[model samples]
Target: MQNLQGKSIAILATNGFEQSELEVPRDKLRGAGATVHVISLEPGRIKGWDKDDWGNPVDVDRTLDSVSADDYDAIVLPGGQINPDLLRVEQKALDFISKFWSDNKTVAAICHAPWLLVETGIAKGRKMTSYPSVKTDVINAGAHWQDSPVVTDQGLVTSRNPGDLDAFCEKIAEEIKEGRHERRAA
Candidate 1:
């Protein structure tokens, strides 16, 4: 694992997030020595969705309005059907994600979280992957969708689903270490 000391990473999520999708990366990144913050739409804790039911609550490190893209080296979006569905419709969420892409910072999304990429207009022309059900949406947004554990274009990293968590988290650390990329703005 890379030594991520001094690196700051933001895990943007909210209630209904896939439990493992959010927990795994947050734990992995923090274990690698990066400061990980769980930023939600509101303060306090947010509940997660497990395979079929509600999961444990994760404490919120900060609310979306309280943080800026400039404070972190990378941003991660954890996917759950409900999580992305809710976030994609929030203009605030969309704009926050767009800022990361526009700044060329590492923008990582796993599973259905890629929906945010499409909404933020950053999926166009990028080779990425997401949950099987999100394939059509990604393609419609002009992305070259692939059926792989993980795919990366520029600083954007994506994974198919929970099965790809290992690769997803590893790639996130790698991308953060690579620093900002020189890519077309969203």
Candidate 2:
């Protein structure tokens, strides 16, 4: 209904992801007519964390090693402390994100997922929002960090946490529809 038909949306996540953060957006984006694919560190499936405990399982669409930046219109990074913290340490995962930025494609990260953006070093000067705990890292990265449900600047979209999934998913859908390229990437 929101004109996202046929758009390919990719979610890059790993084990220990916040379940709601991943599920909410995945469902919302799919409902908006985008094909949502979950790309994880491994093939098969990845487990999610819900409120300090293990949650449901989500089947993986592709492994990070097999995914190419050009295959999808947008990339969503769902964060939990362990998810992004672990991903940030993987050069391949961080490199995959930078590829999206360099291509000026839509890249959205929620919660601690913004940590990947910091590691990518492509958010400098772009207005962003992330879980409050990472505000300092965002600021030090030269990005304007804010306290909000969602923040979209250029081709980058960010949200504070799972609580902001409504706004987060909506903004990501709109960004894909708008086709706004990242200015810094250009």
Candidate 3:
């Protein structure tokens, strides 16, 4: 496994996040020596969406209002239609993401999570993947959409769905280790 002992990963989401998408990656990253911060639109706990119904609650470590991009090494956006949709509307969440790219930090978004990327207008000209239905919106936003389980572009890594968890988790940690690959002058 790649070393991430000193890295901090920020996961942005809200109520209705997919159970596995959020928990699985968080645990795996934590086990690999990264401090995973669960950031949400609010404090306390965020609800998990399991199958078609709601499930367990995960505590929120930081609110969108309090997250500082420079405090963390990378940002993760877990997917479920509801979570990403809600996050995209919060200017602070979107701005935090923009700062990730501006500083060449990694940003990983899976399943429906890329919706927030579309909201930031940076998906343009990049290659990525997501749940099939979101393909249209991604393309409309000017990205090259793929059918792969995971696709990483310009430090942004995206996965298709929960079925791709192994590939998803591996890539996330890799990107976290790949860490802050500096962008070239355009």
> Which candidate wins on lDDT?
1
How close is every model to the real structure, measured as TM-score? 0.97, 0.95, 0.95
**lDDT to native, each model:** 0.93, 0.89, 0.88
Q: List per-candidate RMSD values in Å.
A: 1.1, 1.5, 1.4
Clashing residue pairs in candidate 1 are none
Clashes of each: 0, 0, 0
Residues 68-144 of candidate 1 have per-residue lDDT tens digits of 98899999999999998999998888888898888889999999999999988899999999999999999999999
Clashes of 3: 0
Higher-TM-score candidate of 1 and 3: 1
Candidate 2's TM-score reads: 0.95
lDDT of 3 by residue, 21-44 (tens): 999889888988999999988889
The list of candidate 3 runs beyond 4 A from truth reads 184-186
